[model samples]
Target: MNVRHLIPTAAVAGAVVLGLTALSACSTSDAADRRPGDKLNVVASFYPMQFLAEEIGGTHVSVSTLTKPGVEPHDLELSPRQIGGLGDADYILYLKGIQPAVDDAIKLSESTHSVDAAKLTTLEDHGTETGGDEHGHEHEGEGAGADPHIWLDPVKYAEVAKGVGASLEKTDPGHAADYRKNTDALVKKLDTLNTAYKTGLRNTATKTFITTHSAFGYLAERYGLVQEGIAGIDPEAEPSPARIQEIHTIAEKSKATTVFFETLASDKTAKTVATDTGLRTDVLDPLEGITDKSKGDNYFEVMQSNLAALQKALGAK
Candidate 1:
């Protein structure tokens, strides 16, 4: 998380270019660009937040994301310009514990309209089983800071959507009606998604699924399935031999058929576990960010693809 110390002094210009490339890569407006508009400048922490802002704020807001597309968000280190650019935002939306740099930068910025999505929805510690690097770990004294991946759960995400809508209404009162309408539409879509997952996964041959990243805890719990993570919370962390053996036992006992991995993270762990267990490997995207490699573009499409993957893995009848 100490990104500043590692910033290379020799590649300042290259880093700037890389940063510019990142800014362009997400295909969102830059918060720092001086624009002649009354549109609210909304800076999002990442795709999940960005999606909500775009869906809810509509034409009233110009949204930008700190974490670029295709990049894993946990290790996201903000450039100095990106950090300073936070002050230019009319409203900022972020989840507190996921990105350390964004959290620190937002706290230091003078943006009063910043909204923490975690505050809008209740967070549950799905524990380390389905946890990943940032969202799934237990904090020392902070009471299991709850999983920051609430956006993965449609119901929970709907809650965050309502909160975001209200916040935007408060920020830009002139567009309150539009924000409310958009929020309702999004929530309705989420409701339909929730129903689909419920019906699709209700009668599965297995209730347990194995995964390399523990990013699907909420989704699993929501659909009455169990998640066995090869690596707890941190995707880069290697599984201990005992843990690997335990997964093998669990996979067999629970009749698990697939070892799932994310689009952004390395699939080696998933493949290794699947190969050893004689189970198939499949993509069960956590829906962190959309990329060319993603099953579908945007949240709803990717989530539908996720539902299909889960149904296939669990052998839904």
Candidate 2:
């Protein structure tokens, strides 16, 4: 189940900035214990990163997550113990900017073997209706933030898998072959998922789908669809009355039949918008965290559920 227990405490700043790096007090090349399959201690910032670590690292790593199941990741605050444990990890995986506290702590980490998955792929602004640049622009410069939810897009997530595999190989040369093989396998699965999305959404009645947050920008861009978010990239941001009215018009004009809310986030906004727009509400998990309430157990299963929901909402042909 890979469930993490919540910790309550203040963060002790300074840990982790991933540059395709390795970790641990032991050296992989010379350690006899590591040669005998001593698992690397890995810390993942959240579910998406945790999934990558578990699937790609396979039997070579012991993984733990900072974000507990069913918890809203953006609201996650790290306890000092959790932050302190980062220094002991052989590898740390996290998507920068998704969890602000973790991002702040990772920026301070001295480890060179850590990986920021966001750096492995391209990120674009999806422009939430609440407030953001609607035009797809590069969020490269300082003060211009890019969305960090790239895992939702299979194509982009595969790019990250390649980077992580290469990095893991360098860190653990003894198991380099295993890491490479696992990475290829994971990427192949992602490729298959991408093909399915392309075929399923190709003949949809409408390209626009309304969502509570703008987490699916990369997914929408990859699939040639439009995502109209009620709030900005920040999931908790309240939509103004004007923005609500704007969505009503958008739903009517675009023929959007559903309002999608995430499992972790509150469905209040989605229901309100759906009620006002004469649209039905459904689940469109962002894959942030999986729980019993999620449509399916793992990343692939939940993503498939999302596909079915989108298919129905978009009236896929």
Candidate 3:
């Protein structure tokens, strides 16, 4: 997928504002001078979230990313100006724990007018709904209970897109109809993609697979697949020696074809596991950032790539 093809010129225009000088100014007053009809001020935590907001908000919204491209969302620290952007935003979309600085800024921005996409979308409690117990919690380690990467899963992202549209409509009620229409269209696209995954991955030759982290809980639960990971909720957490040994044993016993790692985190541990088990390593992007090699510009292409990877890994036709 060509990213340039997926992104509209308007989306590219929005990204133009994210230069070093703009990021350096990070002042609320600077954002305030831009004028109201110029665009609805919106801030998204990372790439996927930013893309969704841009898709739904369209020309009516001017979207900015709180976390810069190529920067790890888990390790992001916000500048005072970035925090001011959140305070000035009509809506701020972010995964709860993926960027602690964003989360903290949202708390502070609440004193003014701003929307919290996570709470508005009710994504924080997904584990319980799916019969999974891996609830998000705060930790000093990399993005605990905040699996801010939920947008990687198409199904979850559809819901988030819907929430973003609804929130935008609320903030700018004049454009509510357009927002709803755009959101509905995007949701239909997501549904089609979801069906493709269900048909492509269900009842495949391989049922068990290993990942570097536990980020796929929503996707696994959505498709009746199982993913065992070397680490826990936090990708930064190292597996216990016993846990690593257990994963190795499981992979050997299950004849797992490949071990998957993500783009945002280090692959050293995953490489070690693959070497120990003699399994091939494959990428399963968490959609945290857009790499030069990424198929397309936004989350949809990344998700399609993920499905293709899974099908290959699972030995599906």
Candidate 4:
């Protein structure tokens, strides 16, 4: 199935924000009334969550994403309509702590069944050298406590898929067998993807890679590679002068071929690092969202492209 990436205009964004305010004061009885549809109504937090919902739920589900394409997920603020209309959907699948506003809104929402994917995997602290202070903690958000880029690791993503499938089964027991079958198929594909990454990155000349942010920790960990980020887990956070200097030093020491930036975030830091270290720059997407700027349409294609970039940068045989 071809998934068309949605981009909301400024007017729509305003409406959503306004809807949130309206929801606080108004009744949502009008919104809660379900329309006739056999497909389960699923609202995903972002691209990765949306992918899992669609893949696991298949034609039995009608999936939508809260975060639009090309927008950074961390900066998302729920519209009043989105907040007020939570009960209109059957389930809301999200990665907890990644979006604080979403977390706050979800807590207030009593209507939708919220499924957090973060619980499906173990989290690790990939805190920056400058992450101990108050400013650092705020900048890191969910990332300060633990890295939330679990979806980058195929095995962990498959685990999340399993959990989501279980939720779907519980919610729609009549389709339990279908959900199980679809989940198994999705897991098989993810396993193949895992093998592809392992084989492609195997015995690279260098194990150390540089990225704009520390979002690739899980991916690097999966493939036995070392990740050096210009910024912390939060892409919006600025690296201090000391941290920048340290990154440059590490780049020189590791002989990193390319400094990588993500599609959704600024490439300024990565470009600056590249300029300082005399290295090239390229994209290594975290699969947060899909935009026209993305090299591929969906998760699998983009991940394969990422694998190729890693192989080139690491000088894989």
Q: Write the per-residue lDDT of candidate 2 for residues 164-265, one digit (tens) a residue.
A: 888788777788899999999999999999999999999989988988766787888889888877765544455777777888888888888998888887
Task: Estimate, for each residue in 142-208, the C-alpha lDDT of model 4 and write its tens digit.
Answer: 2345767788899999999999999889887778899999999999999999999999999788887
Which of candidates 1 and 2 reaches a greater TM-score? 2
CA-RMSD of model 4: 6.3
Error in Å for residue 310 of model 1: 0.5
Report the Cα lDDT for candidate 3: 0.67
lDDT to native, each model: 0.77, 0.76, 0.67, 0.76
TM-score of 4: 0.84
Model 1 lDDT per residue over 135-212, tens place: 343322122336677888999999999999999898777778999999999999999999999999999999988776
* Candidate 3 per-residue lDDT over residues 1-317, each given as its tens digit: 00111323343333333432355455543233555567777778888778888889888888899878787676665655565455456667776655555555566445244555566444443432222322232212223233344665677778878888887787777778989999999999999999999899976776777787656766876787767766655454556677667777777776678888887777887888778778888888877788775656777788888888999988886
The TM-score between candidate 3 and the true structure equals: 0.79
Q: What's the lDDT of the predicted structure labeled candidate 2?
A: 0.76
How well does candidate 4 score on lDDT at residue 70? 80
The parts of candidate 3 lying over 4 Å away from their true place are 1-37, 120-148, 233-240
Where does candidate 2 stray beyond 4 Å? 1-35, 126-144
lDDT of 1 at 22: 53
Give lDDT for model 1. Answer: 0.77
RMSD of each: 6.2, 5.8, 8.3, 6.3
Best by lDDT: 1
